[model samples]
Target: MREIYNELKRHSGKLTEFAQVLVDRGLYTNTKHCVAMMRHSTQFRQDVQDIYAEWKPGKLKTKDTATHNAKLAEVFRSIKKKELKEKVETMCEILEETLMTVTLAIKHSDVRKLGEVKANIENILYGEKQ
Candidate 1:
């Protein structure tokens, strides 16, 4: 019973930590930022779980079993690589929009108009970008 309780506590603690990550990252006014953060946190937790599973002893092992470990490691690496690639793509879109807005404001907006335009763009991008 004590072992079961300990295991429950361990899992609950991990979930609590992941929830905290969501709360902290939720501060971003942008939805994409929130989405990216949550996805990253989830991926990190999954990676940890995969490593833990791999490290635990199996009921049996043969020469083939060693190859299984290597394959699992490759799979984990691939998952992380894919996630990183997605994040880069999202970041590029955000930066491109910001740059385009700034350029348009410079070209067409006057001093007073620029302030209003900037504020509007901020509200649109970062939900009142402080």
Candidate 2:
């Protein structure tokens, strides 16, 4: 802000005094220019992305975990179309841990062996619906 003020002082034929609105407009214009420059900077973009990642790490992880597990849940549906209608218990916890393991395994598997990994997991944990 002071930099903008000094520059404005020197720019208009080295004026010693300026109107209040001119100073205000100079500050506003400088702010907008700085914002535009930041918007165009790759480092600024990365900094913003880092801030968002820092802001909600847990929420983002939970959402990602849900999405990843949904893929595993589709495998579950291969054996049964039924949804748990009861107040499920520790078994649900076990099932979730097991599913999460498989989900992570599938995520880390080699691209070439993806189909094999998925097929093997489904064969072991579930079978055809009919």
Candidate 3:
């Protein structure tokens, strides 16, 4: 579980960097750009789901009681880190929000509406004041 969590943290960091690049490239509107962003976001979401599927909580049992207790303690400690959990949750939220914005932009054919959505996404991704 710790390993999976660490992997998720790393992936989230990568996603942040990727999102910055997309913002830099001005690819925040239009169907093509939205599709590209959605592809990356979808891939990350699926990867997380796959990791979650493989994670089994409280499954680490051992013949040695002392070792089993120690392992359990370690797992609990790792999972109890509030900051790490919050960061993961925030990252997932950002990705989902971006995907939703892109889907909306794709559905609306009005250029002005797409531009507004793009501006909103920029603010969301970059913390820019709107």
**CA RMSD for every model?**
23.5, 21.1, 30.6
Give the count of colliding residue pairs in each prediction. Answer: 0, 0, 0
Model 2 pairs in collision:
none
lDDT of 2: 0.46
**Residue-by-residue lDDT tens digits, candidate 1, 26-110:** 4445545543444444234554344334533441233587788999999999999999899677767766776676777678754
Model 1: worst 10 consecutive residues (lDDT sum) = 1-10
TM-score of 3: 0.27
Tens-digit lDDT track of model 3 for 1-130: 2343343345435334433444555545444453345454533455434534554343333269888899999988888897678866876786677677667767875455556666656766676784
TM-scores, in order shown?
A: 0.38, 0.18, 0.27
Could you tell me the lDDT of residue 92 within candidate 1? Answer: 72
What does candidate 2 score in Cα RMSD to the true structure? 21.1
TM-score of 2: 0.18
Compared with the true structure, all predictions reach lDDT values of 0.53, 0.46, 0.55
The predicted structure with the larger lDDT, 2 or 3, is: 3
Report the error of model 3 at residue 32, Å. Answer: 88
Pairs clashing in candidate 3? Answer: none
